[model samples]
Target: MNLLHANDQAGAYPPSYYAATRTPLAEFPALQGQIQADVCIVGGGYTGLSAALHLAEKGYDVVLLEAHKLAFGASGRNGGQVGSGQRQDQDWIEKALGREVAHKLWDLAEESKALVKNLIQNHQIPVTFHPGIAHACWTDVQVRDSHVYAEKLHRDYGYTHLETLDRVAIQNLIGSKVYKGGEIDRDAGHLHPLNYALGLAAAAAKAGTRLHERSEVIRIDHGATPVVHTATGKVVAKQLILACNGYLGNLAPNVAAKVMPINNFILATEPLGDRAKDILSQPIAVADTKFVVNYWRLSEDNRLLFGGGESYGYRFPDIIKTTSKPMLEVYPQLKGTKIDYAWGGTLAITMNRMPCFTRPYPNTLSASGYSGHGVAMATLAGKILAEATAAQSERFDLMASLPQQRFPGGAALRWPLLVLAMTWYGMRDRLGI
Candidate 1:
């Protein structure tokens, strides 16, 4: 089953809290007949929209095609934490890619966070970025490791936004007795993801990008000049960008080999009112140390937007049942709270947990496998893609240079292999080992 349609209807966003509260963008017409452009971007999520916007701003004719609505996939459905660093921590990057490259990646990550803020400010996107992301640790060892990592970031990278939190401090802040200790990154923040995506779409369109919704890409003819075909129409362009992320399917066999798609679920509670303070004393986001991380934050209306649970299949599991168990574990007092909305989204991940950026063909570029840290990075990726298209390829090449490996098994068997590995990790999380 195509993940895009396996769990959702055609041309409709999931019934997520984000979709319920989105800042609406008027629908673009589906692609018809044939069109020509300088760049043809597949997938209208953050990467595609950002690339279109940046390219259009640089006087390049762009066409962006979306299978459903813009931001209709993980981009709109995810927990909105604009996290610090790449999906892997600085220590991991340093160990694997050396300190020099790690430092450059760190700087790029910093720029990504800034880019998101600047886009919101410059575009006047109707979203508020409340700062702070608390890392709630369940074990003392984990807490100590986190503190050390925070120090490493400060000493080596000159990052100073982290504040260590003791057990009492964390319990007081999160109103949860389970966490032993953790740290808070004051620079990291959260926002309404769907609204931000819609705002980007609006900006891209205003910058002269031709966007087509419900125009799913069916085939691509790759060469010096690439042709992307949809059911209703085709796009002939000087360059092609594959920004499909979790919904990429078999469109590009090489990218599909290294990037695997997994499903994650989230649930939003009814407005907590005064009880909001009981869950989070401050307006910030929190992600715990679980292998399948539990992330949450308060909505502007005071609702708890909690995300957890994972499945490897194309179809989503019972979202409320799968997510609420973990939600209640963190906040047992919320056991009886009304769940206002529940949804699931697919996000892609690479073997080493870093994003996969590559030139599958000389004239074709593809970026996906953001792991869980796509919000800011995906936005930056758009600008980099635009830069590459403009023959200013330093940044894009730097990202593509990161080492990547295919899943242990090929596409046909990767799913089973991942399920086995995730099951083992989930067991470790349960055993608290």
Candidate 2:
């Protein structure tokens, strides 16, 4: 019943396949008194931590505050799929912002993936980086469009890597007949998101970023220099970057309005073992081309980590079974597969499916709303913000140029609007519309 403490996810990470098998030693302290830094970042997820690491590497004294532990939010509890591109496709993206800017943005998505790869390798973060991710579709036309997307991406953008899979090829690859077909992006891949966050936090700390756990930012006073006031202490920073994403809350009404939070739920099945072959043809992340995307990938121990559906409120929807029913439709034999763990995390989406990157005040900046594609994008966003702070502002300027609007209602009424929108999408999923 606490206004802020989401207790449901406390034991939420209990000895899950992720906790038991992966993750390294965690080491961040709680703030005891007032402190100051060059940059004070809010939110301990990928965006904040990534920025902390970049700034720390630049030897700028940095301090990062997290309401909960690092990765305790959406970053920790995601589907673990590192998807390519922005929320929308390059075609739509180009159409939205014209061809030239779209080309630069699409190029950034590719760079985002490489940035993650380089960070993991440089830090030696022991995360599983496998090749290939496929999008499953229900009809032939959808399959054709998937192929055409790949062809057009290559033909127009000089970008090539997406391979089209036919119905038979998809069946052979997915071990599921539910999908008519889809496309596989060999360059795009998956990883343990929580583990990755933790790894970045460790590296950030090692590189001299002061990470304060359980230090919740209550308010911010913006000016030529900025200050972040927390429960027990405050940070007097020369500049600020709000990387909190969907959880931005009342920190900045403008940010909260432009970025609407939606809950995304994920479930891990009991170890599939021999039955693992019954799902993925190869050990790769799989996403279905549905309005509510069904994204699934295997864990280190071979458990199927499946995620889909959205709830438009603060409460994690009581609909994991409802959202995952379609997985049964795809692989019917696994009816009693025993969901070892099920939980939901919140992710933000923008009206245009574009991220919001801007300065709310003179020295206080905010960047969020990559939607579900935060793993790599958020990390890259951190770097962009750091570069902007360093005075090389082109990247940040390009990102800031993307137009995004807040939900019609404020946070209080935003939920109802989301409820209405999601209800329509849920109905579509049910009706196959």
TM-score of every model versus the real structure:
0.99, 0.96
Candidate 2 error regions (>4 Å): 1-4, 7-16, 310-312
Q: Cα lDDT for residue 104, model 2?
A: 92
**RMSD to truth, every model:** 0.8, 1.8
Number of backbone collisions per candidate: 0, 0
- Clash tally for model 2: 0
Off by over 4 Å in 1: none
TM-score of 1: 0.99
Best-matching candidate per TM-score: 1
Which pairs of residues clash in candidate 1, taking residues 3 or more apart in a chain or in different chains? none
Residue-wise lDDT of candidate 1 within 1-433, one digit each (tens)? 6888889989998988899999868999999999999999999989999999999999999999999999998899999999999999988898899999999999999999999999999988898888999999999999999999999999999999999999999999999999999999999999999899999999999999999999999999989999999999999999999999988887998898889889999999999999999999999999999998999999999999999976656788888999999999999999889999999999999999898999998689889999999999999999999999899999899999998998987867888989999999998989998
Per-residue lDDT tens digits of candidate 2, residues 230-302?
Answer: 8788999998989888778788887778887777777788889998887886878998877888888888788
